[model samples]
Target chain A: MEKKYVIGIDLGGTKISGALATVEGDIISQYTVPTKASEGELPVLGRIIETIEKVLEEGKAVVEEVKSIGIGSPGPLDTKTGVIITTPNLPFKNFKLVQPIVEKFGIPTYLDNDANAAAIGEYVFGAGKGTENMVFITVSTGIGGGAIINGKAFRGSTSNALEVGHMTLEQDGPICGCGNHGCAEALASGTAIGKRAKEAVTQGLKTSLANYENPGSYEVFQEAAKGDDVAKEILDKALTYLGICVGNVITSFDPEMVIIGGGVSQGGAVVFDKVKEVVKERCFETLAENCKIVPAGLGTDAGVKGAVALAILESK
Target chain B: MEKKYVIGIDLGGTKISGALATVEGDIISQYTVPTKASEGELPVLGRIIETIEKVLEEGKAVVEEVKSIGIGSPGPLDTKTGVIITTPNLPFKNFKLVQPIVEKFGIPTYLDNDANAAAIGEYVFGAGKGTENMVFITVSTGIGGGAIINGKAFRGSTSNALEVGHMTLEQDGPICGCGNHGCAEALASGTAIGKRAKEAVTQGLKTSLANYENPGSYEVFQEAAKGDDVAKEILDKALTYLGICVGNVITSFDPEMVIIGGGVSQGGAVVFDKVKEVVKERCFETLAENCKIVPAGLGTDAGVKGAVALAILESK
Candidate 1:
């Protein structure tokens, strides 16, 4: 008997990723297309469709066995209604993508927040496979998260649950895009790191980072690794905020494990080691001892694969 | 057929509340004793035992009918191993209450932090009934919290989850007992409210609160309600901190609902109305629209009843 497959799409500001995968979550074929978001939602969505078509054409056998399609995108979204209310990175407002995809494919389609999909992906195929309850945090330009309870994504009463980055780590600290003061994202996100590095340079602190006319957080991390004091200070502050955020998650969710992903996490052991140390030092010993913080295994493919997982689960 | 019963003991610094309840959570009889914790653990344990016996006797239930006993106390505690590691309010360290209770009744006994028990109680019988995921927060002298997921108390990896008060709301705002700066508890707890009020008076802020040589949070609330400017200022500041804390919970946990309990909450609609307004204003609009902030329904009985709920679940 031929096994069934699902199509997963991850829509981002600059690119659209599409994949054909088995019902078991194994990727069979994948494709990508540039998303000219400046050209607006219609053009970018057309590119998404083009990418999906390309993936399906390449995975003809899997496409013939395909049951459904799923899409993961940045949110404020209405997962139940399958509408993207307003994604910060995308030039779309209340875009109804699910019905359009379902109409195009003549099969069921599901939509979820990117973070939520990534969490489901991790739970189904990554570090959280064995845990009954877990939380997945993605620390990129902005931090975001999703929770899984009893092996299912926990989307609160609405699909807007798990805004992990917006939680206040300091009340009177830096301002976040969300208009909050001292949010974890405001203190520890890649943007925050970059901003801090720039401030240090502007404040006349001597640093090798002065070499970059406009340095980003990755550059700061690289400089810190090379023993630059200003870069180290920025990295330490980010790590402290990250640790506090992790500790707060432990105190609030009581999940068996926490899986972390995202761009800044690409710093690898440096980020993980410091995060673990701070979480342990700050949270209650019992919680600190029991909760393991692990890096996400699926890497960049997590979102698309998670979308595929959602398709399979919803179809079943 | 005769139904089995359980004994639930809520041990606090000032009072010991014990109840004999059916496995379905119906209270047959209850008793209270002075904890007099300053007198030490042994004496307190004797009082707890006496209260349990009195409750059972009053209910006309024999020891054989009781399936198990559950104790809810302040922590740090070892719920997995059933030991009270240390309770700031109850002069106890490494106290093994579960073994003694099990030995006396010849039935298994369970121990949990009071906040955890209260959360379970709310989940099973009070505000959070029928919800698979929720957070219960008690705003008393200090804030405390418990998380419930999939119909069970979420004890984290080590059974010390839900330390909501310790999460940082302000990084450099105030000193906390946990040696942290600007913890939610340090910024918004009842203690914080009183401390801030006293500080205002010491700083020569003109107010009717000066009528009391030493004013507690309740007195401040009373004064604020009666139109005292200084009291209003202090109350507003406390509410701002609390609102931020509430927003933090929404951002962090994304639960369907949050139940607020404890003495400060008993200030009636004033506290709830203000907290709700500020939390909605401050949190992510999507999250704020989805989550409900409700007052705790079980009132003061939440702790003991929560213990009963835990015992019944464990016994089953």
Candidate 2:
């Protein structure tokens, strides 16, 4: 069999990362560019195209050698038509993402929400490898996630399922960015943690967290790890809410494993241990018994790897 | 195509319903018998076999004419091994259900937790017909559910993913049968409604619901519709929980439609309207915009129909 290559791209609000990989998923070359998305779609698209061209150039591979291009973009996208419906971070709506790339390279292009790509990436090469069903959740600026079932990305009716982060954890609780009350993202995400810490300071309940102006989730975790009571209280509460979200996902999806990734999970044992404890206590015993809760193995590479997986699988 | 017939059985604590259906899902004959579960597994199994025999006899079909046998029993069962792990409402543990039925008739047999069967049933022939993905939720004695994705029952990694009823809705809320705190079942199930109403009456609340000796969810709904404030409050709260569950399911699964089943949904528009309202308000606009919230189409026959769906699909 002749060796085949594919181009994988991860499109984010701040940066675009592109890579050339073998059909077996080995990255031969990669390139990155700042998105500067506020400059508008054309410039961002130019950067994305430049990154892809640079990866190919660095790999010394011709376009003819590449099987296809796959992109994982911040989305609520239409993978079927390869149209980006809307992205919170990028200024694109109903953007014909695939057609433009396909036209440029005369190759098939596939598109999926970044979260879904991460899930497929993990399922194909990371923590959930060899599993028939799994959920990949990323707790970053805001919680986001995707599901892989029966060894494929489980896109629902509109090619978008696995919006795990938006699941309502508490009724009539805090309002979320998506306008829902008490969604998992609103209660347990990095943004939520930072907001809670800020609120504590605003309420005049001073602690070590107050030292960092406009403290983010990382600062809060740092203070908590040092045994700061106020910071510890906030972290514990946020982790507890995250635990409830994990429990709910387990009960609903019953995946073989759940892979936790993102900036928040970088807290390591502090996050996974607390969340796993809640899941063990809350999920159905049978499900809990079979579920392996683990951290994502691919890390930053999840985006490009996932895009590659999507390209390979969908192309087949 | 040659005409093919299959047998489907819905085994419950109180009754066992069996039906003979063509491969195309036309039910030709059906039978039912008392489970008398307290009489033990052997007696319950005997009743189940009797119902299957009666259905076959009524249809004038020979064992050779039946393609397979499918049973949907109260679950937490191993679909791969055809074993009933343990049912909260039934006295069956590690029972080799499929092997026994297969031996009795020398026909292939498939067994699924009842909720999964109902999901397939709805997907194949009822409310979710023609959809690629759907969720079937039975809000009955206790809330339970299943999913049909890409035209197949979505048995999670352990063949038990769609435990929608056990999802955590509120932190530190009521305990569920599954021993979880603030689960959807604990907050919205018929049993929960009755328990809440009984508690209200016990608390010396003045309401017409007090006229009933043991008011179940039905009596509470009736009184609430007739202007009982206490009953109205209880009903509204329960519906809110149900709506939240529905909303959460929508976001995570992104199914084309959600088919609401169970005894509680028998209240019809009164229940559906309120729940749909909540789902519309809670789900991400992209998801909620396309989701169709409707009542279960098969009504009481969901079990047998779902079992038939399981039989036909699995046999293929």
Highest-TM-score candidate: 2
Clash pairs, candidate 1, are A171-B170
Which numbered prediction scores highest in DockQ against the true structure?
2
True contacts preserved, each candidate?
Answer: 0.71, 0.90
lDDT of 2 by residue, A213-314 (tens): 898899999999998899899889889999888888888898889999999999999998999899889987778889898999896578888888877776
Give one digit per residue, the lDDT tens place, for model 2 in B1-316.
Answer: 2438998998987888899999889999999888888888787877878888899899998888989888998877999999998888888778877877788988899999888898888888888888888899999889989888887788887887878888899998899887879999999999999999999999999999899999999999999989999999998999999999999999889988999999999988889999989988998787888999899988768888988988998887
Candidate 2 docks with a DockQ of 0.85
Enumerate the candidates' DockQ scores in order: 0.54, 0.85
TM-score of each: 0.85, 0.96
List the candidate 2 regions with Cα displacement exceeding 4 Å: A1-3, B1-3
lDDT of each: 0.84, 0.87
Scored against the true structure, residue A196 in model 1 reaches a CA lDDT of 93
CA lDDT of A178 in candidate 1?
85
Chain B alone, model 1: TM-score?
Answer: 0.93
DockQ, candidate 1, comes to 0.54
